[model samples]
Target: MSTETVIPKVEKKHLENPTGGSKMEKVPGKPFMEIHDEINDEGQGNFPLILDDSVETQTQEDVKPKRMRKLTSGGQEMYEKEVEKYTAELIHYRKNLYILINSYYSGELETLEVRLMPDRINKELSKYQQISEKFIGFLKRYRTAESAREEATQKIIFKSIVSKAKTILNEIEIKLKQAQLAKSFATGRKFKPPSASSMLIKQRAKMDAAKTNLRFASKEAEPERLQFKLEEEELKTKAELLKKKVEAKLQMELLKSEKEVAIAETEFNAVREELEMEGSRSSGKSMASVVDPRQHIERYLQKQQEIMKSVYINPQQMQPPELNVHAAPFEPKSEDIRQTNYEINNVSVANELSKFLLKKESIDVSFYEI
Candidate 1:
C-alpha cells in the first residue's frame, strides 16, 4: 500500500457548451479530452472538427470564435424585444438623417442662418433659368444670322461667276464667228469683195501706178509727176475759160435780140397810133376810098393805074367851107377826135392788105360792074 497521487488534466472543449452539465461523465483523477465534431444528424465519419480538447494541453485551434448562437429560450424573448427597440431607434435616426439631407438639398435647412434662404435659392434658380433661356435664344438667332449671311454670300459669288462665264461664252462665240469668216475667205468661194478702204496701202499704191501708166504713156516716163499734173490742171483751166468766154458772147447776143424785139414793139405801137389817128380823121371820106385803100395801100399803089378805073372810084366830096371874110378858123371837136382814135385798126398793115386781096376774090365782081 504505497501511497501514489494521480494528476488530472483539464482543457476547454466547446466554448458554446455550458460550464458544467450533469449529462457529461466526469473523470476523477485522469486527464480527459472533449472534442466537438461537425457531422450530420447520423454522426458520420470524415466530418469537419469544429472543437477539440486535449489533456494537459490547450490549443488556439480548439478555441475558435464563431457567430453567436440563438439565446436561451427566456433570453430569446427579451432579446427580440430589445432588438425591436434598437431597430426603432436606429430607423428613427436614419429617417432623421435622410430628412436632414433632403432639407439641405431643398434649401430648407438654412432657415436658421438666413431666414429666406430657400426662397432666395428658388428665386436665384428662376433667374438663372430665365438667363439661360435668353442666352439660348440669342445663340439660336446668332446661328441663324450667320447661316443666312453665309448663304447670301455664296449666292452672290455664284451669280458673279455665272455672269463671268456667260460673258466668256459670248466672247468665244464672237471669236468663233470671226474664225469662220476667215476660213470662208480662205476657201475659193466668191465672197463679197473687200471695201476700197480695206485695201492695203501697198496694194493701192501698185494699182494706182499701174492704172496711171496704162492710161497715160507720157506718165510712164514723166520726169516730174507733179509738174505734169500741174500742166493738165492748166489745160483744164484754159478750156474752162474758153467755155466761159463763148457763154458770155452768147448771152450778149441774146441781150441784143431782146433789145431789138423791144424796139420793134415800140415802133409797132407808134405806127398803130398813127394809123388810128389818120383813119379817124378820114372818117368822112368814103370807106372804099380810105379804109379799103389804107388796108391794101402797098398792093393798090402797085396796081393803082390798072385797078383805079374799076375798083377805085372817086368818093363824093362834101361841100367846101364858105370863104366868108367875117368867119374865124374852125376848131376841131373834142368828141370827133376821141371817136377817131377809138375807130382805128391796130393789126399789121401787110397782113390786112393780103386779107383785102383775098376778100375781093371772094366777092362777085360782076355785080359791082355796070
Candidate 2:
C-alpha cells in the first residue's frame, strides 16, 4: 500500500506560535498539545491517521465568526444572544450537576459514588453554588437594555462568563474523578463486619475516658468547693466579730452616759442642800426681832387720845403728871433690834458671796465681815 501523507487541520488560533510571532489565542477547551498527546497515545505512533481523523471530525463552522466582528457593526447584539444561549446552557448543566450530586449522596447513583470527605464535598458544593449564583447575577446585569447595547461592557461580560464556565467545568471534572475513585474503591474492596474485640475495645476506651473525666472533675472541683466553704465561713465569722464589737461599744457608751448622769444628779443635790441650809439659818434670826411699823404708830395714837381726855377733866392741873408707859422686859431696844436685823441680812448675803469668790482668802474675809 502506498503511504498517504496526512495534514492536520489546525485552527487559525492554534496555528499562531506563542513566542515566534503574535501571542497565541487561548481556546476554551483542552490544549492542542494535550489533545495531540492523547491522540498519539491512542494511535500508538499512527500520527498521520489520527490527524486525518481529527480533520474529518472537526468542522470550520465551529469557530464563531460573530466574535470576530467589530462592536460598532451590530456585533454587540449577536454577542448578547450568544451570551444568553451560553448562560442557558450553563444553567442546564448546573441543574443536572446538582441533581447528579444529590442522587449520589442519596445512594441512587450507586455506580457513581463520591469518595470525597463529606466536609470537602460540602465546601466544594458551596463554592460551586456561589460561583453559579455570581455567574447568573453577571448575566442578568449585562442583559439589561442599557448594558446590553454597550460593546465594551459586553466584551467584559463575555470574558467573565467564559472564565466562570471554565471554573465550573473544572469543578465538574474534579467531582467526576472523585466519583470514579469512589466507584473503583467500592469495587476493589470487600466489606467485613467489625470483630467483637474491636467493639469491646471501643466501649472500654469510652468507659475509661468517662472515668478519667469524672476523676478530673472531682479532683479539680473539690478544692474549689472547700475554698468556697472556707471563704463563706470566714465572712460569717468576720460579720459576727464585727457585730460583737459594735454591741460592746454600744454597751460601754451606755454605761458611760449613766455614770455621767449619776454624777450630775449628785452635784445638783449637794448644791440644793447647801442653799436650803443657808436659808434656814438666816430665816429664824431675822424673823424674831422684825416688827411691823404700822403697829408702833397705832400705839402712839392711843397714848395721845388718853392725854387729851385727862386735860379736859382737870383743867387746874395744867402740868399733867408725866405718863409712864412701861415696855415688855423681853423686848430689845429699837436701835439694837434694827442693827441685829441688818447683821442677819448681811450674813445671808455674805454666805452667797463666799460661794462665788474664787480665792479662799476672799471667801474667809467675806464671812468675817458678816
Candidate 3:
C-alpha cells in the first residue's frame, strides 16, 4: 500500500432541500433580516404578503382628494331654498314633537306610536338644533366679516350646515319609514278585505241557513195558521176547563138539592107523624065532644035569650020558656058522658048555664022589648 495523500472532493449544490439549506437561502432574493425589517415596518409579522398591493392601493386612494360637486348660483339658490324648506320642515316637526311630548307628559296622547315618537323626535330635533346653531354662527360670521375669503369660508360653513341638516332629515325620514312599516304591520290587516274563499264560504253558509229557515217556515205553514192553531188549542183547553167547572157546579147543585129534598122529606115525615098522632087521639072522641067549650057557652046564652023573649012576649003567662039543654039527639055513650063530665068539671059549663038561666029569670020583663 503506498501512503499517498487522499483529498475528498465536495461538490457544492444549490439549496433544494429546506432542512439542509441555511434559513437565509430559503428566500429567493431578499435576506431574512430585510424580510424581518419589512414585517416589523408593516407592524404585523403574520400579515400575508399578498395583501401588500391592496394596502398600497388603499393608501393611494386615501391620499387622493375626494371629488365634490361645485354648486352654481342656481344650484346654490336651490340648495338654499331646500335648506330653508328643510329648516321650516324641521321647525314644524320640532313643534309637533314638543306638543306631543307635552301631551304625553300631561297624560294625553297615549298610544304606542305617540309613546315611541318622542325619542325619535328628540334625536332629530337635537341634530337639527346643532345644525341651526352652526348656521346661526355662520350667518353671524358672514354678517360681521366683509372679506371675500371670509365670505367664501362662511358660504362653505353654511353649505356644511345645510348638508348636516339634510343628513339629519334623512335620518328622520328613515325613522319615519320604520314607524310606517311598524304601523303597516300593526294596522294593515284591518284594512285588508276578506279573502274571496272566506267570503264565499260565509255566503254559502248564510244561504244554507236561509234555506234551512225557509224549509222550517214552509214546514210550519203561515204564521197566521200557527197562531190560529195555538189559539184553537188554548180555546179548547179553556172550554174543557169551563165544561169541567160547569159539571162540577151542576153536580154540587144536584148534591145540594138532594140534601134539601132529604131534609124536606125528614121534616114532612116528622109533621105527618105529629099530625097522625093528633088524628089518632082525636079519632077516639065524638065530633060534639070535640067541639069547642065556647060553642057550648054560646048555645046556653041563646037559650036564655029565647026564654027572656018568650017571657017578654007573654007577660000574662009568667012561666019562662023551657031550655032545650039536650039538643044533641045522639045518645051519649059512657066515654062521651065521661068526656063531657070532664069538660064540665074543667070549664064549669053546667054552672055557667045555670047562672045564665037564673039571670034571665031575674030580669024584669016590663023593661025588655021582644
* Candidate with the greatest TM-score versus the true structure: 2
**Whole-model Cα lDDT per candidate?**
0.44, 0.48, 0.47
Cα RMSD for candidates in order: 42.6, 19.0, 31.5
Runs in model 2 lying further than 4 Å from the true structure: 1-193, 282-370
> How would you encode candidate 1's per-residue C-alpha lDDT over 183-274 as one tens digit per residue?
77888576678877777876989999998878788765576887799999999999999999999987776676666556555654555455
Candidate number that wins on lDDT, 1 or 2: 2
- The TM-score that candidate 2 achieves is 0.34
How do the residues 221-296 of candidate 3 rate in per-residue lDDT, one tens digit apiece? 8887989999999999999999999999877766766665565556544544443443356444333343443465
Q: Which portions of model 3 show Cα errors greater than 4 Å?
A: 1-231, 279-370
Q: Write the per-residue lDDT of candidate 2 for residues 113-186, one digit (tens) a residue.
A: 44433334455545545655555555445434333233233333334334443444565568778877897899
| Total clashing pairs for each candidate | 0, 0, 0
User: After best superposition, candidate 1 residue 71: deviation in angstroms?
Assistant: 99
The worst-scoring run of ten residues by lDDT in candidate 1 lies at 46-55
Q: Decide which is better by TM-score, 1 or 2.
A: 2
Residue 357 lDDT (model 2): 33
In what order do the candidates fall by lDDT, top score first? Answer: 2, 3, 1
**Which whole-number lDDT from 0 to 100 does residue 5 have in model 2?**
24
